[model samples]
Target: MNIDKPHAGNKFFLSEISFLGYVVTRGGLRPDLQKVDAVRDAPTPTSLTHVRAFLGFASYYRRFIKGFAAIARPLTNLLRKDQPLTCDGECERTFSTLKEALASAPILVRPDHGKPFILITEWQSEAISAILAQQGKDGREHVVEYASRTIPDERKNDSAPQGECYAVVWGIQHFHPYLYGQKFLLVTDHEPLLALKKLTNYTGMIGRWAVRLQEYDFDIVDRKAEKHGNADGLTRLHRPGKVPKGEEITSWKEPKQSEGLEYGQVAILPRT
Candidate 1:
């Protein structure tokens, strides 16, 4: 039998048979292949609307980008109230940079429940706050998420120490629902560490804020200024103007734990 030519009278049926045989023989039968849906083209975003759309998407994933809000400040300013602006060279540059940053931004990994989560909280001011979460394993740490916010003007100058305290309290409280039933560490350099339990006497808004912090299960560890260098770097990264290079300030002092062992002791052990 000549394989290239139809076998006989039933040409159409022979062609169908040949095609089916070729498909089955060349690509082994796969149930998943049968369920494969036809590929559909994604609609292209309009250039006029792409900026806004991409920025919104970037904002949604901002926690994955260090200094995101700070980096995008120039671009965000364009959307502010009564601001006369044009998407000129500077705007276009910022827009393009942001788009590129968004495209290359890393996906945030979920925190490991079996591991202790480290939160480095920074109060750039009473209202402007930031937190960097890192997971430790086999004696190393990697960032898991970055969170930062600027308090409304009404909240600034309220009491730097108390505000920082409240920020941590509220931050943990806000993130508690997701992190409930898990062990975590809080990092801060504020002197409030000596007076955290006395928050109720703080007075004014700070006093009210302190009441909410009493419910969380956490221990406040004082990060000496020298130890908190990396965390401080993260705070400076959120400051106005260009961000500097090098490792953001981070601290690794052992947190006091129950059972007469420090949290860092267990985490620093080599993984088998």
Candidate 2:
């Protein structure tokens, strides 16, 4: 795009670099300490405008914080159109926690397709969350990425089974780019959801969701709820406010008749 000169941000022959607020290195993406310091030393938000400004900035690094939606819920509530601007004890606490979370955020490593992946998904009435991890050379699992979001308002009252099914579906969709053809372990805390693997001709909300799974390869595993406490405590993470570049959030039921896929071929769902 430049006829004579390149952008000032361009650099070559560097061992590491900071790009779009994150530090890029062979190990993976880490938060820039300078940016983290700003968040850590930020003063209390005394006005509605201040609150919004802070969230807008923090959301840029939302990928670093696991349960961002839950932690920011109280603060976001204040953003309601006609709500009064008040920072209660909970809001004050949440704001502090956010600052601390950024300061202590872990370095999220880059995804290596060569290694096997383990995806853990759990859902509650208020939210649905998932964590994608890989076994590092250290023989310990390290998180690759985190994704979570509050369920749509109208579906908040869905039964436990329905919510759990929704979680699995959304989790897969959110990480589709990395998971499309790869065989990975799909972990779920809801025992009822494990049954989807054997379901045949099932026709309902859950059935339609199962049909989407035809696009990927995975084996479902069960985990206990108590084991998922960290994710549950905030009720959990992702790029948070914005979709990652190159991701296409598509409707569930529509299959692209054109554009043949490279990995697994899509199969038409039979009528129930």
Candidate 3:
């Protein structure tokens, strides 16, 4: 596996270079401009196979594309056996949007193992998304990666609390590789979720998700949805076109109180 396979994109002793279809430099990792240009220039797919091929290429750089799964969900729906392969208005709009996103995609920095991470997950009416990041030496928060997925139709009717709980579990698992073995902050706009650590197996869905999270080392923080615009990108892909009824978020209090708003904010929880 030496220069014996140079075409395979092997490199050595270079601070900045293109490796496996991405640009690597001090700034961060980004998709090769030529590849991005090809996607932007490609025409809309007219068949199932063509759609799959296009998605395969776009997925290669999904790490740099936020909410990629939700954005591509429309096209994926067309791949269903019971569904027709025709590209509709929704599919066409999604295809162009994905290309535009890739064209202007952000540069993602690699994680710093020595530093702590901040994970933000949000449920925006129709989808769930999260961003795993860390503050770099330069004092700016750098993104390790972005994740998001469309909410299934059956689950759309779920209660807001249920959705919020799911986001915490889903987000942690999605970014488990970077989050495991380190203490991190799990930011959420839902204050009720702030009590996540207090739940047990006796609780319903939230409790179950809590059990799954016991092995991880992290704390949940409450940030109002207005200020939560950071990880709110992906959910906008679905046009629920509605906002949650305004609910005031209370400031998190020190843990170990009995006010028990049932699902109010809790600053820190200790293992009993």
Candidate 4:
């Protein structure tokens, strides 16, 4: 390791250092104070170039923002082809929100390999999001990372339930390196996931997703939607149009249980 200020001094010690727009301390990693202030104090972007520059700077610390992609959607849209460069009301609001989110961003800790993780997901008609957190020694959950994205045009027509399932699959895959070998709890408000392992009649995307999920070690637990605030906030922020209508799947019922193993646990699935 190369140390700065390598003068004739015998040794130098420092408590912490700021590197690449992040502060490193014994406690955890946090966005550098100066960078946070820069984002907060930045003027509302007036053109596409300005928007992109601000986004480029802000994107560096996006993991600190709970739903960054959703929050910045309006501003990003300005950069799309044929879109106007003007900062509309939505764009201004998004810019402000991003600054606020960054200014108040939390200090995230390194993932402790010894501890188990918790994965929570949310899905709406427009976007899907997930949060990875772990219980700290103080018994409170701390966020490891957040992920969210707008639904592409090809999937805009998926039902809400399917979207939820998609969120799970996407979330798991996004954090696969963190979760591959560990046992983690998968929490969601969607009840269909509780019966996911036993459903024999699922078709299309949901079926393919379920098959893929069987390879992971996890337990699916249902939590009230209100409790999933982080991911819920992400999905709700960037909904762009009227939700897909008449795509509801009303026939999925809770599967009957067999033996001690419930359908929600990760167990060997019969080959399709």
Candidate 5:
């Protein structure tokens, strides 16, 4: 029972302590500044480590990049066990694209709970979705942020008019609790704004949805498809296969017959 003699159970613990002491005496716990600087200033990865670091940063801002996980699938495959990752032409292109996207990542401004939020949504036949949020302040409306995504094929064919409509509903639902009794505007390119007035029963899923929508006052306005060109392009970028360039060029024509709604005007309809 001598204190100098280590018990069998404590032998492993003593060994760990001895090793740690040796390490500490050999060098302080802090890393070598020169080595640390070398690592920091080291050439950016044109290889596996670079890809992983870029992916890590991309993940940090996943909200800004819709369908980010899906988009990075190919790059992630390079990180799997025993897999040889080569920075071939294709990988190099992707690496450059991701780095560019990361460098110029858009700064999203948080929504103001007090100001009215306007959501512009776009729906595509392919089940892609995009949304742009603008808030009214000081007698003017300015874009607060943007978000977009491509829904799984299975989920696309649902009764929802467009992926953007679903996206809009989801965004509003997310902010509903904070915005209860607050007024907001739902902007869409869909033509069925009048049909939404037919909603009466507030019980089933659709009804519940209507109820939640009703809680916070909202008016559906037609945002001409052409006007949302930028957002539409972003939604297409999330689409599953290669998307051709110049497909986003759209010409917005003035409505032939006007609802006569002026910009920034809100049209409120009586709840059905």
Candidate 6:
């Protein structure tokens, strides 16, 4: 094949480009050295305001910091209402750890829309978290993005299964800009979600969630809880809603078939 192009100021091929504090290269996206150095050289915070400032700056690169929420918990806790402003030893260590993590942050590759994405999600009483990643040509998963947030106090007491179910919906919606018209794989440690379509008596909330999920194209898979350490740590600080023992899901049954609609199938597989 032969290709020809007129010399143009805005159409020349280049090895890489810096955009939004990230360096986009042929291999992947990496944090800009200048930005990384700025965070690395930031002074220790003595006030809550300072702490928040630091966090706001560092957060832009949180995708490079695995277990980011867990690592920054000590610092974030100080921001709660009526909490003391003291920067304890733990907070100091967290600051240093965050700086170090940013300095050595991984380069996340731009996802190939043609490839299937793997979404990992976790749920705790106060938080829902997820990681968007994809398997590389080298057969290793590469990070694409990470998202997490605290649930409101009012809804914090939702049942464990419901919370898990919400994690699925929230994660997919969070990444809707990328997932809206694509097929991907959803991975979760919560078995209940994988079996959601099989539940004979689904809750109102679950029913609503299932309906919303129908718009997307994807597959759900169940993995062992122990293997989901990436998204797990983001929600570790929150207490988990408990499920009593012996509560077997005897109502498991296939979801009803809808005319003109095909539900995404759940695929159960052994751990690699």
Best-performing candidate as measured by lDDT: 3
**How high a TM-score does candidate 3 get?**
0.76
Cα lDDT computed for each candidate against the true fold: 0.50, 0.74, 0.74, 0.73, 0.48, 0.72
Rank order by lDDT, top first?
Answer: 3, 2, 4, 6, 1, 5
Off by over 4 Å in 1: 1-51, 84-107, 125-129, 132-134, 200-202, 224-272
List per-candidate RMSD values in Å: 21.3, 16.1, 17.2, 17.2, 19.9, 18.2
Candidate 3: residue 197 lDDT (0-100): 87
Model 5, span 147-215: residue lDDT tens: 544466566576654344465566665455544677767777777643454588766555555655565
Instruction: Using TM-score, rank the candidates from best to worst.
Output: 4, 2, 3, 6, 1, 5
Model 3: residues with Cα > 4 Å off, grouped in runs:
1-15, 152-154, 233-272
Candidate number with the higher TM-score (1 or 2) = 2
Tell me the lDDT of model 1 at 37.
16
Worst 10 residues of 2 by lDDT: 261-270
Instruction: Choose the strongest candidate by TM-score.
Output: 4
Put down candidate 6 lDDT per residue, 165-220, tens digits, no spaces: 88888889989988888888999898878766554654598987887787888888
Tell me each candidate's TM-score.
0.55, 0.77, 0.76, 0.78, 0.49, 0.73
> Lowest lDDT 10-mer window, candidate 6?
260-269
Worst 10 residues of 5 by lDDT: 20-29
Question: Cα RMSD (Å) between model 6 and the true structure?
Answer: 18.2
Model 6 earns a TM-score of 0.73
Itemize residue pairs with steric clashes in candidate 5: none
Better of 2 and 5 by TM-score: 2
